[model samples]
Target: MYVKFRKSSRVFLITVLFGMLMILSASAQTGAPINVRGSITDVAGEPLIGVNILLQGTSTGTVTDYDGNFELRVPADGVLEVSYIGYKPQTIPVNNRTSVLIVMQEDTEMLEELVVIGYGTVRKDDATGS
Candidate 1:
């Protein structure tokens, strides 16, 4: 008795092999997530809670817990931006930083708002002239 694979069977087998090869190649080129751990604190050296920590240009983010500790997994070699409501925003390179401690200073200068009145928008500083 002799057994042989039909043409369609051979084509299906080849297609499956090609798909698996592509999947494996793609996965091998992908990098793993880098672990990031940090603590947020105020200028006075006190731990600041509820501080917002975000990776710049991405939606990945986390908030400091009550102990002012935050841990997140970001793609390797990404940039991170840290900010809080009353504190100045800071941007840091995350290339080799696995653990970090950041002190955020309060922003004393308030941002003036611009409003649109009638036909055009006016800056808060120039609103009186318009």
Candidate 2:
């Protein structure tokens, strides 16, 4: 069997194959969704309640339970970003791990400042009454 493709036809065929290959490779890299379990704590080893656990580059996320434990289904290679109020956020790579532990550090600079609503910040000497 012999089949010949015209110049334009060949270009279109090649482009289609390239597009399929790209889609396949992207899906392969992302891999399958796996259950990941982890916990968040402070430097003192106390569970941090209501901590935010988000998948980097994606809107999928969850919050910690009262015990600071969280479970989420994410891509095998996805990265996890943990955050909490008054603490430094941490980014951890999944790397196919089934379990993870995160420790949040206090953001001292934030604790020392007074953030004014809508106004950003104002010095105590500036004087304000609302």
Candidate 3:
């Protein structure tokens, strides 16, 4: 008058239950994606175009438009790394902020190479004097 489950059936049931619990717990731990918007500018307060905007620790990234404005979807808590040529990179923390404005500073170091010859200054490649 009673039904009994075989060993394989019991093991399968336990495995299914465990998997469900794991999925539920994982869903509870991570948050939903949020819309994050931001803009990038230079010290002169001019919009910086084509800036690389990347989500920290992830391959997800975007680039600033012609107006240096970008909208990215990220977790409520996330970090953004903004970079451009000739400018110092900036790391910004989301912290649940929906909007952000950043000003990029110029890198003061110069990488130009020059050689002083007996006559005048020449490019590093053109210099053949010892």
TM-score of each model, paired residue for residue: 0.61, 0.71, 0.67
Q: For model 1, how big is the CA root-mean-square deviation?
A: 6.5
Which residue pairs show collisions in model 2?
A: none
Span of ten consecutive residues with least summed lDDT in model 3: 108-117
User: At residue 60, what lDDT does model 3 achieve?
Assistant: 93
Estimate, for each residue in 44-110, the C-alpha lDDT of model 3 and write its tens digit.
Answer: 8999999999989999999999999999998877899998866788899888899999999987552
* Candidate 2 residue-wise lDDT, 13-102, digit = tens: 999999999999999987789999998999999999999999999899999999999999998999999888679888999999989999
The TM-score between candidate 3 and the true structure equals: 0.67
CA displacement after TM-score superposition, residue 93 of candidate 2 (Å):
0.8
Q: What is the C-alpha lDDT of each candidate?
A: 0.81, 0.88, 0.85
Where is the poorest 10-residue window by lDDT in model 2? 111-120
Candidate 1, which ten residues in sequence have the lowest lDDT sum? 108-117
Tell me which of candidates 1 and 2 scores higher on lDDT.
2
Error of 3 at 128 (Å): 12
lDDT of 2: 0.88
- Top-down lDDT ranking: 2, 3, 1
